[model samples]
Target: MSNKHTTLRKPVLLTSLPLGVMSFLLPIYSKKLGMNAVEITGLFSILSLILIITRPIIGKFTDSFGRKPILIVSCILFAASYFIFSIATTSVLIYAARIFQGIATATMTISTYSIISDTTKENNFSKAFGRIHSYKSTGSLYGCIIASIILSFMTFTQGWKMLFLIFSILSIYSVIEVIKNIPESKKIVTVKCDINKNKSRNTMKLLIIVFMTCISSSILGPVFMIYMQDKFTNNILLLAYAFFPALISESLLSKRIGAFSDKCGYRYSMIFGILICAIISIITPSANSILILAILWILSTLGGVLYNVSEKNIYTDMIGESCVGVMYSIYSIVCDFGLMIGPLVGGILYDNVSHQAPFYLSGFFMVIVAILILILIKKDSICRVD
Candidate 1:
């Protein structure tokens, strides 16, 4: 990787640390604040709904105005979100935080991916994206560790505030890094383009796959923490320990799998990955022991690692370089569409149906995703650039 790529990832790494903490705490916190299952999931749906609206505009700005400014704004918004999370006493405040967080995600995620696409060679996309994801994993792991420690020492309320406050400060540090070190990734360009028919078709197929993948994954989001709390001990440290293996394995292997995807076909890798995850999801609801659940989680994460690394590279391969930012935003919009629906459905299923319903449904959708991949994404489309 070049110095520029390295620099770009630093802010991403830093921000991801806080994101990890938020992921671990947000649902639990929402529950504590008297939110029901549907309400808890609604927060995420609201966030994704906002992303669907905002990401395209911000993504276009990145392509036109350059990546650096949008990235810096993203960092600041992250800090703002963290601060709001820190002070939140009601669901309304949490809702506001999700809004800021969603917008921040729209900007930072699009800008960072665009930067990687701008800086790296086409063939090296998986390797480069792998490293970026690995960095995010590393940061998230450490963030969880830190959160565990904080929760270990303090009351839940105190620890929650402290975690958000500390990460809010760290987000500022990321902002400074962006201002000082990161360079603009691409020259400013207008988004006008005459897209090819094949490229457009491939991009649409890829986005459909992404949408299904999001649904399959997000179906578990609203229920995961609640399930853990009910089934396992509520000790934050123990929860973190259970998650450690998956995070560690994902961090270590993301880059390697990316490199592997670069050599082997992304289609094969993605198909295999999705099937493995689908199998795991099918079995997860049956695990009676915490250890079995943890094991299942680890396997599921590995499958996700494979699927995500390969899928990202394939999208980059399919889209034109000039409108990559817009294309990525569009991709995210489709993915968020799934995210918005999945959690609501998951929450309702958990509340009205059975706890296992979401997992079963997720697995079913994942199988559909795999089928879609097999039929829609042809070998010729993946192997050769049109």
Candidate 2:
């Protein structure tokens, strides 16, 4: 492993922990606060919209002021958001917390991604990202286990509040780690001419691919949890169990899968990943029991990990070395645009149309995205990092 990658692992893991803890429970917590499907998913839409607006600004800052400072700001914002979430009772307060998280996400994702792309070699992209995501998934797994243990002893309200408080403290610690341990990325100047010449058209293609894929994933975002709540046990621990094995497996497999992508080529791995997710999404609504659903969820998550590792590799290939921060933020904007649309439509469809509408739509769209990837992305289309 590279020295820079080694330096980044702990902070990356620290950053992902809070997100993992929040992923399964946030919808339930929002529901407890009187949010319906629309409202619960609307919070995500609001966050994505904020990301679209702020990411470019954060990107510019990342390029100019350096990555470490932006990351520190992002960690502080994450801490603040969790603190607000711990105390929130109203939807307004929830929205406020999500807004803070949105900005944090904008800063955190762009800077971290840029730093990785800047430091890692192009051919090693998948392996490096895989190893990093392994740490991230491990952190998330720990968060899920910890949150489940806390919930096992307390009422839902109390458990969620305590979880957010714990998340806040973790984020604060992450901030200190960033300040003291993480090193700044060295600027890349050698490849500017090549990057400037070829980046535009390929960048557009990548953005479209990302936007559609985001829609595919987010189409069932809040609605899936709502369905689980209605049909299965409302116990958060059970939900955590459904994810626990999957998280462990994904964490363990990330590096191996990344290495596989590096050797076997990105196209087939990405296509297969997308198809697996599509198949699982299509089959999920038909699950008759929690066990069956957990099995399917595990498959879906593994598929997602496959797609994500390859996708990040492709995305890093597209990034201009000289402006990794700004380019990545632009990429994130496209992702958030799709994310903003998918959840709103999914929630509306679930409420007014049918519960299965979002699932089927999500599956169908993923298949289309997979086909698009097969056609649009090619070996020569991807630029190498210098």
Candidate 3:
């Protein structure tokens, strides 16, 4: 990587790390605060809904103004939101904190992604995106390990508050890193209203494909750990262990998949990913053996990495420089929608039906997404050419 790439990487890594920390700490903390499953789900659902509504406006602002101002403001909001979360005594307060957090999260993520996509070329997207994912995974690993240690030595509530403080400090550091190290992309020209000016049929197709891909990928994200805990005796250690493979595999193998996607085209790469994920989902329910479950978990991670790398690169390629932020925001919205729905649906199915039903449903959805992507590729080939 060049010096410029290195510069961009630092801030991206720093920003990702704190968010990763929050991801692990928040749920555990929520439980400690006496939140029921329904409350927890409702909190996230409201957050997702807020993000879905706000992303496009944030994306538009990033395009019209610049990435730096939006990013800095968002980071500050992110930091302050944690303070509110730390002090929350009621469910309504929790909901309010999450709403602010959601807005900040959406703004920071969309702006940063827009900056990275603008800085990197189409051909280099996979490698860059892979590195980003790796940084994110490393952050998650560190946060989870540190939080676990803290919880072991202290009360859960105390550990949770400490984690929130840590995240707030990290957010401040991320802001500094962005200011000192990451340079603004020289290629991004200020656009007034071009975000909505031109829309190609291919762009619409790409957006639909990206939406489907996100929905399929997020099917198990929120509910999987819960399922594991319920079935395996609610062992936190075991739950953490089950997650290790997915995180580790994605951090290690995503770059290779990204590089492959750059060379082989996003369509083929995503197809392979979706197929593998579908297979894993279909087999996951029948795994009476822990060993098989672990293997499937790793495979699912591999598939997710492939899908992420390819789909992101494709979105950048399709939208190009003009509307990258808006495109990414749209992607985020669809993804969060899926994430919100997945847990609710999974919980209902697990309660009313078999625990295995969620996996089958998830697998079936992936299959549908895979077929949609294939159809998109055919349509694009018939109408557009280089």
Q: Write the per-residue lDDT of candidate 3 for residues 11-47, one digit (tens) a residue.
A: 4554455454465556666777798978876776787
Q: Which structure is stronger by lDDT: 2 or 3?
A: 2
- What is the TM-score of each predicted model, taking all chains together? 0.90, 0.89, 0.89
> Model 1 Cα displacement at 173 (Å)?
1.1
Off by over 4 Å in 1: 28-39, 188-191, 194-199, 228-237, 351-353, 380-386
Model 1 lDDT per residue over 181-297, tens place:
988778554655444432477788888899889988999887877777777777765776777888898888888878777777788889888999999988887778778877887
Provide the clash count, candidate 3. Answer: 0
Pick the lDDT winner.
1
Clash counts for all predictions:
0, 0, 0
Top-scoring candidate (TM-score): 1
Q: List per-prediction Cα lDDT, in the order shown.
A: 0.83, 0.82, 0.72
Put the candidates in lDDT order, highest first. 1, 2, 3
- What does candidate 2's lDDT look like per residue over 98-175, in tens digits? 999999888988888878887787778888888888888898887777776888899989988898888888889988
TM-score for predicted model 3 compared with the true structure: 0.89
| Cα error, candidate 3, residue 81 (Å) | 2.4
